[model samples]
Target: MKGLLYLSLIILIATILPLVGCNGSSEEVFKGYQLPPEREEGTTVELVIHETYTDEEHQVFQTIVDMFNEDNPDITVKVERIPKGAQWSRLTQALATKETPDIARVEMEYIATLADRGTILPMELFWAEDHKETLVEGAILSNTYNKRVWGIPDQIYTSALFYNVRLLEESGSDIPDSNWSWEDLMQLARKVSDRNPDVIGLSYGSSLWELSPYMGSYGATIYNSENKRIEIDSPEVVKALNLLYGYQLDVEGWTGSPIQSFINKDAAMVILDSNSIPKIEDSGIRFGVTKLPHGPAGSVSNIDGTSMVIFKDTEHPREAYEFLKFLTSSKIQALWADELGQLPVNKDSFKNVDVNKHPYLEIFMEQVSNVIPKPALPNYSQMEELFNMEMQKVFKGEKRLEHVLMDITSELNGETQKD
Candidate 1:
C-alpha cells in the first residue's frame, strides 16, 4: 500500500511540474491574443496594468509592451482591459479588495481622489527633479495635488469652438478666428439662428466643466483651492452663467445634447474636444475649428487627460515606474500621435509632429497655450455633480440662476469641509 501511494504521488508531481514549466516558459496569452515569450529561468517580475483602450489601440499598446519586454527580459507586463465607462468603479473595487494592479491609467480628475486615499504612489518620489519640465504645459499640473504629482500624464487635449462652415457662409457671418471674443461668438450665433430658425445658434452644456472656461473669462473660478473654499456664487460667475443662459434663452440653443445637435445640423456651432472630431467628420459636417472666444481671462478651456499611476501597494514599484516612463517617452507619444491621433503630452513629441498631416491638431496646438487646469481636489467630482444639478435647475426654469449659484456654493463648501 505504501509503495502504491508513493508511485501515485510521483505521477502527480510529474504532471504538475510540466504544467508549471509550460506556464513559465511559453508565450503569455490574454484576451485571445498571444504575447512575447515569458522566459522561465529568471526571477520573473510581473507587472499588471489596468487600462481602457479600444481593440486597435490595445494592439498598438501590446506592440509597445513587447518592445519593452524585449528590452527588459526579467520583467513581464500584463494589461487588463477595462471598459471605459466602468473603469472608475472597477478600479475603486479593486483598491478596496486589495486586488489592484501594479499600474493603472487614470483620468486626471481621479488623481486627487486616489492620492488622498493613499492608494497611488506619488510620481515625485521616483521622478527626477527636472522630469516635469519635459511634459507640455499643464500636463504635470493636471495630476498634481497637495504639492505633489501623483501620476504621469500620458495624454492632454482641450476643446475648441466648431462652427458649421456652410451655415456661417449662408448666414453671411464673418468667419470666426482665434481672436474672437465671447460677445463675437454670441452675435454670430444669434445671426445664424435668426437667418434660419430651424437651426439653433449654439450647442453647449451647463455643467461646471463646460461652464468653467466662460466662468474663468468672466473672472470667476468654481473653487479657491488655496483658500480651501468654494467661489462659485460670485458676481462674475453669475454674469458668465447669465450670458450663456441668455444665449440659450434667446436662440433656443440645443443644450439637451450638444454633440448630437451638431451632428444633426440643428446647431450652427458647438464646443467640442478632439474626440469629437472623428465623429463630426464622419457625419460629413463642413466644419471649421477655432479657439473658444476669448473671455476676460483670455481664451481658456478646461485641460485634462489620462495619466499612468503606480499603485502604492504594488510589489514591482521599480518596474512599474520604468514602464510609466516608457509610456511617456517621446517615441511612445509620437506613436500615439500617429496611430491614435492622441494629443501628445510630451513637449518634444509635440514639437516633432507633422501638423500638415494632422491639420486638426494644429488648431488644438494653438489652443493648448490657453487652457485652465482643473482643480485637483479630492472631492472635485462630487462638487461637479452638485453644481451641475443646481445649474440644470436654473436651465429648466425651476430656479433662478443667482439662487441656484448661492445654494451650490453653500452645498459645495459643506462638501469641502467633509473632505
Candidate 2:
C-alpha cells in the first residue's frame, strides 16, 4: 500500500510537470519534477520536523527535539507527528503542493523514490559541516545510490519467527530452536495444525516484504546487485514459491492480519519484527522469538528502518544540517535504541545496551546479523507491485511457477529501460 502511494505520487507529478517558471525562464523538470531552491539565510532558522509516530511514541522523539533546541538556541525546530498509516496520503498531499518538511523520518525504501524526484537533499552536504557518524548496518541501501547518501538510518529491525509458547505447548508441539531447519518448521507446523483445525501453523503477510525471509532463505534473489538487473527466475526461487504454495493449499496456512490472530491463539506461530514485542507483551500471550529456520541458502531475515533526511529546498540548509546531525548523533541514536527496544545503526550505540538482557531481543539481535535488505532502485516501488501480483498467481495455482518467474524477470528488467 505504501509502495503504491509512492508510485501514485511519482505518476501524478510527471503528468502535471511544470513547463516554465514565473520569471519567464524555462524551468528544468528532472525525473522527480524540480530541485527546490534554498531559502534566504538568517540568524534564526525555523525548521519543521515531520514523521509518523503515535502520541505515546512521540515522547521519545520529542525528548530529542527538546535537547536539540536547548543545545542550539539559534535554531527552532517544530514537530509534526503524523500517524504511520496516514503518512502516505499526508506526504503525497504535501508533495502535490510542492511542499515537504525541512526534515522527515522517512522509510529507507522511500529514499530512492524521493531522491529521484529531486526533493531530498544529499547527506554529503552536511558531511563536511557536521561530524556525525551515521548508523548504516541493517539499513536498506535505497538511500545510498551512485556514491551519494540520502538519509541517516535512525532505527533498524529484522523479521523473526515468534511463537506462542502456550499455543505450541497446548498443541503438543515442542518449541523450535534458534538453529531449526525449514524441514523442522514444517514438521512442527503439521503437528500444531493437526491438533487445532481452526488454528493455522503460522501467519505472515502475503507480499514481497513478508515473503523476503523465505525467499532469501531459499536463495531466491529479486535483484542482481552486481549487474543491477532483476533476476527472479532461478531454481531456488521456484522451490521457495512451491513451499509457500504448499503451505497455502495443502497446509491451509494463514496470511495477513497476523497480530490479532496470533493474540487470539488461532495461530501457533507468526513471523514478525522486534517492534511487535510491545503488542504481544500486553496481550497476555506467553511468547518466544527465534531466528527464521535455515533453508538451502541459510537463515535470513528482512531489514527495515526509518531514516532522517533533509529537504533540498529548505531555506536554512546550515541550521537544518545542524539539527539533522544532532538527530543522528551516536549519543542520541544509542539512547533512542535503548528507549524504544529498536536496533541501533551506529557502532557506538551497540555497546550502550546489552541487547541480550531484554526478552526476545537477544534472538532478534542475532538474527539481525544474518539479514537481507530491500533493494534500492528508482523503479523499486513498481517492481514490488509486480512481485505481489505474480506471486499471488502462483499461490492461487492460476499460473505455472516457472512461467510467472520468467515473465516477472523480463517485465522488471524491461521496466528499467523505460525509466
Error of 2 at 298 (Å): 3.0
Write down the TM-score of every candidate: 0.84, 0.79
Task: Write down the lDDT of every candidate, Cα atoms only.
Answer: 0.75, 0.71
For 177-244, candidate 1 gives per-residue lDDT tens digits of: 98998998999899998898888888788787778878877777655656656678888888888888
Error of 1 at 10 (Å): 67
Best by lDDT: 1
Question: Candidate 2 lDDT, tens digit per residue, 1-419?
Answer: 11122364345334322211111111121223333355445557789989887666589889999999999777889998878878778777877887888888877777766666666777666575325443555473545644467777767788899899988998988899877987788878878888988778877666788888888899877666666566677788778867876777767674547778898888888888888888888999888888899998899888887788777667766677778677767788768777777776665556666565565666776787766666656656666766676666666667676776765565455432221
Instruction: Tell how far residue 111 is off in model 1, in angstroms.
Output: 1.9
Lowest summed lDDT across 10 adjacent residues in model 1 is found at 20-29
Could you tell me the lDDT of residue 12 within candidate 1? Answer: 36
lDDT of 1: 0.75
